[model samples]
Target: MPSGSLRGQVALVTGAGRGIGREIAIGLAAEGMGVGLVGRTHETLTDTLKECARHGSRGVAVTADVTRHGSVREAVRAVERDLGPVDLLVNNAGQVDRAEVPLWETDPNHWWQVIETNLRGPYNLLRCVLPGMVERGRGRVVNLNSGFALRPDGNYTAYATSKGALLQLSDNIADSLAGHHVVVLDISPGAVATDMTAGMPMFQDMKTWGSIPYMVAVTVDAARGRFDALHGRFIHAGRDNLEELVRRAEEIREADARTLRLRPYGPQDPMG
Candidate 1:
């Protein structure tokens, strides 16, 4: 593919104020896609907007809360008014409990708040953006996910649960949009050294971490539909060899790999 294949395209990335979201927005703009920086902080979003402008791609900043439907709708409208209808949507805004504790011991309000931010945040964006994508018969969605979605985290119930639900959400949407040319993918950046990770007690002494470049590359690929064959599947940026995964795309579909699904017992089992 050409370097500027995404020229003139528009991408709206949530949580674009800082961390991985900020980096991804700049990277996308560097690839020739106009970017919409959506976040709660005007100053930080403006900072990212300026960086995108340095890349020679148009950038617009919109302040909005992802968990609110009306706010998301307005943000989408603002992006469209300035950039264009979003061709790529990155659902990267998320939150984790400030303190890790068992579900029962955790504050109920905080637990649900995390859930609302992680899951409902994406839901709100999807509802606002997908209608136009579907109408145009094309779009791409990259849902930032985590390993905890596949494995339970004893002390991180809300985060884990929301991510797990997000995986299912991606799969379900993929099914609904199969022939429409709109693709949805789940990407796990795997412990990037971000503000969120730095604040986590479990990662306080961690040394090794995933590369942000790899994560951005995966997002870029998804935006260009390079992984359409693996739509609705999870991409583990830190571990999965993307080239090999692409080569074995057929095999993955045949074996039903990289997606969330019920584990089948032996063939003799009734459910199997």
Candidate 2:
């Protein structure tokens, strides 16, 4: 909320090796927050850590498979040892299906692999880091979600389903964390140009791309407590008018907006 407000804070970011994750880690560092760069590749993580250090922020490059609970725990332990208790958790590690094929034509093993990485990755990290955050009575989690999670996609079924499940997971946790002084927000960086997206055939024809810097700003705002009021809700960095959302947080809550829900047919409907 104020200048230097984030100084001395600790942030643990999964998939901090590259893309949006690397941007987020550096942004946090620029705000003077010590950052833990977690990813499977040590070289990339080290590169990110070096940049974070340029901001005079403490940083650690820890290599670990996010889908494994034990590996995640050890990684978290290492970060805490180097950077202090984690004040923020950025769940950015995820992947999409290699081919944008229909479910009937998709390889079952590959589908499961997508689920394991995209869904289970964040689950492992959340479980490992949340207890400490709750104990400390302060923390924030920013889940890198996707627009695909909100609608049915004819292709990339695995990616869509896993992201949808992740959205549900975040929503459920937000309710459980109601009084814990911790907040979790899901954000979609719509079709940003990254190594991952570049490999995807669908994005090649796309002209406009999401703003990487805007996504970084959103994370910074979350860490600064700007989006605490919108916990468990989905925020789109590429399209959302965040200031309007914050100004009308009360309206959003009253109307149950920005969340996954069953639409009512009419006022007389029992589900409404």
- What tens-digit string does per-residue lDDT give for candidate 1 at 1-272? 32776899999999999999999998899899999899999999999999999888998999999999999999999999999999999999999977878877999998999999999999999999999999999999999999999998988999999999999899888888878889898999999999999988999989998899889888998888889889888988888889998899889988888888777687787766
RMSD of every candidate to native, in Å, equals 1.6, 1.7
lDDT of 2 at 271: 100
Model 2: lDDT of residue 59: 92
Q: After superposition, which runs of candidate 2 have C-alpha atoms over 4 Å from their true positions?
A: 1-3, 265-272
Per-residue lDDT, model 2, residue 232, is 86
Residue pairs with colliding backbones in model 1 are none
On lDDT, the candidate that comes out on top is: 1
State the lDDT of candidate 2 residue by residue for 1-272, as single tens digits.
22556998999999999999999999999999999999999999999999998888889999999999999999999999988999999999988888878899989998899999999999999999999988888899999999999999978998999999999998888877868888999999888999989988899898988889888888998999999889889998888888999999889878878888888899999998
TM-score of 1: 0.96
TM-score of each: 0.96, 0.96
Local distance difference test, each candidate: 0.92, 0.91
